[model samples]
Target chain A: MFTGLSAFPLTPMNETGIDEVAFTRLLKRLTSAKVDSIGVLGSTGSYVYLSREERLRVTQLAVEYSEGIPIVIGISALRTREVRQLAEDAQKAGASGVLLAPVSYQQLTDIEVYSLYEMVSKSLSVPLCVYDNPTTTHFRFSDELHGKIASLQQVRSIKIPGVPNELDTAKERVKQLRTLLPRDVTIGVSGDPYGATGLNAGCDAWYSVLGGLYPDICLGITRAALAGLSESADNQSKRLEPLWQMFQKYGSLRVVATIAGMQGLTDTPNLPLPLQGLDEVARQELKNILSILKNEISLP
Target chain B: MFTGLSAFPLTPMNETGIDEVAFTRLLKRLTSAKVDSIGVLGSTGSYVYLSREERLRVTQLAVEYSEGIPIVIGISALRTREVRQLAEDAQKAGASGVLLAPVSYQQLTDIEVYSLYEMVSKSLSVPLCVYDNPTTTHFRFSDELHGKIASLQQVRSIKIPGVPNELDTAKERVKQLRTLLPRDVTIGVSGDPYGATGLNAGCDAWYSVLGGLYPDICLGITRAALAGLSESADNQSKRLEPLWQMFQKYGSLRVVATIAGMQGLTDTPNLPLPLQGLDEVARQELKNILSILKNEISLP
Candidate 1:
């Protein structure tokens, strides 16, 4: 069911609780930009850092104001039962689907990984998007495991990270996934820089990072690529190259949190102590990049 | 200062909440068996899975019932600020020291890694033990970084993981740490099989795993090694060779959870869903191991 650009934003927070006003405004911005769907409490959303109650509160706010932009709740946990419980909670909260990345501190076996998706997906009526994020979970899904997991009853989609491997191109990886997976299973690629290329190469969706702050820009690129406008998509991607470089260098978490603060969305943008956003030099660089991109890209 | 054997157990849980009765009983069992110290809310304790409130409750129970034994609280988080807050919370809760691993999903630079410890240690009044569990954190520490962290003002100890790496033995790593670090700082090693060897090589402590369920065995090995009784220490370690092999094959988290369940400490062991504790066959193998060890090593 998941297709096109899914915008994932940083969870704006203040000292007291979530900055509801800023968050609502951000949601409104996404709806205005007409992104395909919105992924809440994702890695970009800092789900791990928030407490259970706080995370639920976030889920509540997201569901309440997503308008028609489908809200796919990220139900990630170290435990399988917790992931299922979270999935149930998301369904009750009116989530369109659930996203899960089986996170573990221990080295999990292939069977362990398969069993996890099997249990959670079977229990959910809504679509479950298997998040293949090796950076966060350290659990890589082989093509064989992907095939086994896709057979699970409610696994409707697969969200893979942007593969920057020198040998295999993202396009080729998408092609392999398309061939390996069932036809109904939606294939989406995340990681801002690699997204445009993946979408152009036949991925069904782009689970976007830049879409969080700049939904219009991401939507522009994603739409262009999807409509077979490769040149336009490449140009749009080139326009955001500076931000992509920052994401590659410092990660989307750091860069996104910095951008949220720079945009004056939330005061306590950086959560989980001691991790301050972009340093002074990087802040200036981000500022210049944002200004140039703003000038280059206009409303659709 | 923490020395000798420190028992670390899994935090028992049921549908209602934390299984406090079972937890208390496990604590009592360790205390009666005479562990030198008790590390509660540690990795083996499932620290990351528990909520902030739950973690504090567990910490409170640990400190209150510890009687005379010191409690070292695990304060690992992705953010430096949360780690600092947890350290402050632990101090307030009457903990002896805090153990931190600087866990991050994103890869951290040497500067970022050292900065995390530097900032947190500066903010903490109590001793901070540097936990080097690269397997869990996915962040390996260089000897140079370890030397710098050991020089932190409040850092009183180093806790290295049981490295089976051919390039770096735990003993050699301990020797290097002891030389590079200040003379007063204590060096401890975890990963049960390596404890006796690390202790014999000059580590002042052994932050153990098996000690949680069977403190007497670990205590015997640690004490013998501390007292320069290599023959006795080797004998004690050799006694645990089977369990050590299981730990290597599957990981301590799986093996320990099974041991706790097999010992009837908790019926529902913490296996982190999708991954159940050692299956029935493995459980039977474990029961055989425990029954044999119980026969071989009598209670003090």
Candidate 2:
């Protein structure tokens, strides 16, 4: 289930509540693109910012709209009990797998984090993915800890932060981790700019932000890399460097929200308050970049 | 409202949920001790671990049982919308002020954080305290940002993480911050081990976890420091070094929960899951330390 491109869409929302119409449109777009899997309520979806009812509703919508694609629901929460409840809810909502990040308010000890994963894994009937997103969760997992968690029952995949930019080093890093994790536990890479590098370095999946929005282009890169066409994959990724630059500078969430809003895929105030869309200057730059990219390569 | 010894109690709970009897008793203890203010739902209270309904109920109870002593409610949340709602609910429940940490999942920008305070401040009728708790929130505040936030109309105090261990350095750090803040705004210090040093160094309030559980002894140190009796304040704080050692070794939250459970102030399973009480060895060490302290100083 965690083998290929997993497209994670934005859960557009405003003051009234979740933009159901906009969100449904996004789900249909991913299903139409035939991406490997659809990830709902991931970091890009702002799962932590939502209420339990809202998260469940989104999960149900994604499963219903994704047209048979496997659904992975992010179930990160501050409390272990809540995380367990969310995991159970997601599985009940037809989730193919669940992603759990050690979302913490207190500085969590290694033992506490281990216990969190251990306890939640027990309640899950479906596969579980260890989401190691230190940038957002602020909980870094040691290699030994990652190994310990991956060996747990129901643990089938590990979503690593990002691989090194250098192709050889990225391969070596992934190789080192491969030996630590169980043979069946797939290693998927996040941080979109290095998608080709990670895939070419032998990562099993690309858990990508760009894939969530522009599934066709991301699928093109993923299919090429997986088929041993590393040059084609790298070329396709290089062609989107301007977008990656904006993502690096303004953050992928804001950049993606900007695209989603400008493209009319979501409402004007797509992101929740305190997490606004890109400012005027950044928006203008993104628009200019998109125009240039459209001339260079195909864009939806 | 934001001065002197502000006791921050644990919102003890178990599988059945918040122990109202235990919580009410803790609130009464703070009121009886005549602490200058009561800080409910601060990090020690596990505010982020709870739901909005639970947090609101806790706030209402704290205001009710504090017997007219000022109450500062922790209004931190991942989303700004929730924080605003919590703040409004807290004020409606008769809280004197609110404390907001830029609680985040996505790493927040300086502008995003500043805008959060600005927006929430507009809706607040009561004063707000800038909770710069980097250890928990993982959002560090620059002096420039602190000056900007402290100047906001509703901002009445800045709860700094801690002062330096050395007395001279602690005084200089506080003095430097004093210059940055408004004349009317006060400065409170958290990180319980530094309570006496912070007070002696001119922090207007000691936001001590120890103060919440053992108010009489903490009050003695706070009062002595405020009266310029540095030696007495130091002596009082030093007498409890064994307790502080446990706090530094095992987090203050865990240490406090252990004590609360041992003294029968709260239920046995006081802390939320994933945040267990001290391990057996640590608990035994704590028990020995408490016994030593009881003989060394007057313990309740």
Candidate 3:
């Protein structure tokens, strides 16, 4: 079962194309921090903007850099065929799992939604993680649907955004889901700052976008929690509060890339068209926060 | 430039996979109709749901059936890279043009939107048609962005859905677009039953989802309008009234597929997951409407 911190690494793109050098550095940082798993080509990773070749390359690089650590590949696509192909690619690249978001454009019926998961799961050999980020997908997976998807032979986990208002509801649903799903299957929380409470509420894993830049702090917190050192975990969480505040201030995508930039994982904090990087003032603020966090944690 | 009817054929799927026989038959029907052009793998064609291979097969079949007739391939994908690759495939398949919608999931910035069009247009050798179906893409192309895309070297046309409140605004925008775009560059209005006025308002083409099922009626209306026979055009418009109402009642995606089913195009109205087919009652009603139109037009 997945537990502790899963870092969604930022995709680096320079004028020449995907910045593999920057990506290598980012991967080394995450692996060194000993994150439970590293997720690639997700929203924070700017998967939507990258071409199929780029996505495949990023997945391969993540697997390579993660060493023995599990690498979860995001296989979100507009069409099932493409998603299936990407899933196949991910498995071939040695990713431990694939994360899928349902087609976002149209509202799918319950049966349609179930079939999408079933088809994708059947097509793949690797364990599937159904990503339930309704904010981007626009279609929320109901508890009943979640239960049904969990029953699929290949689906071993679900990653849900930890929005506050829906936190309790998701918790209740996951609690019931635990009964329906196999004992080994995991239920993970995304949207980290808000997810801390959900993790405490018994979610099997906590996914952190901010962890891409501050893996040490994220790992520190996870290690503290794992060792049952509540006071130390609280201190790490408090120390990372300013960075989380920046995430809240900047949009999620921008903040994610900006954090990656502060960690020197990427140069420009560039996002694909429709999404832009943070302005100079915000960039500097993010840098300052990273500096403070590094000093406090004595992160190399 | 694209003044007549265009049939967006429904993709055929069977037990073995894409039903090439049914696909060929459907394409032959539209080609025999002598449609001004054929839009392959469009919304009416179930573009979003098909696998990359299925999409390519449908495009190739349409091109083969039409011989020299223009074929416009729909290129709507969540990832920009897939869109580029699809554009290349469309070009290789001998498609005359490619229609691209903005990146489906993310709310793109104006600059990102511009860059998407620029990149796709640059990648393909054929003329590109900018498709702005905000209903599905969830991202509206502003007049400024549309104008900028129109100005791109390879962009030859645009397809805008004619929603009621936005009709006049679309007309005014198209008027400005005409000035910015090349004289030969066409502006096509989708949502055809409701878009006749936009055609009259000077759009170069009327793209129809209903045309897939009712090519005879669509062609008749187009011919009448081109001949300046307003009364005849009005009569043909009246013939489409019932079917248009059914489209509104059944939901756009299902109704488009149902039209293909009614025309003996495909079995099972295969919508990829998330979109369901019409109920039996709606299907029967659609069949009845098509029967009436066929008899009225003396079409086989």
Sorting all predicted structures by TM-score, with the top scorer first, yields 2, 1, 3
Model 2's chain B TM-score? 0.98
Q: Score the docking of each candidate (DockQ).
A: 0.49, 0.74, 0.35
lDDT by residue (tens digit), candidate 3, A1-300: 367788888787853468889888888988887889888888788786676788899988888778788998998886665677788889888889888987566666677778778888888888888888876787778877888898898888888777343546755755876776777678887877755555655677778887876687677767775566655665667776887688667656787776666555578745554456777888888778768877876654
Query: Candidate 3's C-alpha lDDT?
Result: 0.74
On lDDT, the leading prediction is: 2
Q: By summed lDDT, which 10 consecutive residues of candidate 1 chain A come out lowest?
A: A267-276
Model 1 docking grade: acceptable
What tens-digit string does per-residue lDDT give for candidate 1 at B1-300?
667787897788753468888788889988898788888878888777666677888889988888788888998876564676688888999999888987866666677788889888888888888888888888888888888898999898888886443324756766666778887678888888888777777678899888887787788898898999976887788887888988888888789888777667887755445556787888888778777877888722
How does candidate 1 score on lDDT?
0.80
Q: What are the per-residue Cα lDDT tens digits for candidate 2 across B8-105?
A: 99999975588899999998889999999999999999998888899999998998888889999999998888988898899999999999999877
Local accuracy by lDDT, each model: 0.80, 0.91, 0.74
lDDT of 2: 0.91
lDDT of 1 by residue, A157-208 (tens): 8998875533247667778777877878998988888887878777889998
Name the regions of candidate 1 deviating beyond 4 angstroms: A14-16, A163-172, A265-271, A284-300, B77-89, B108-125, B151-153, B163-172, B268-275, B284-300
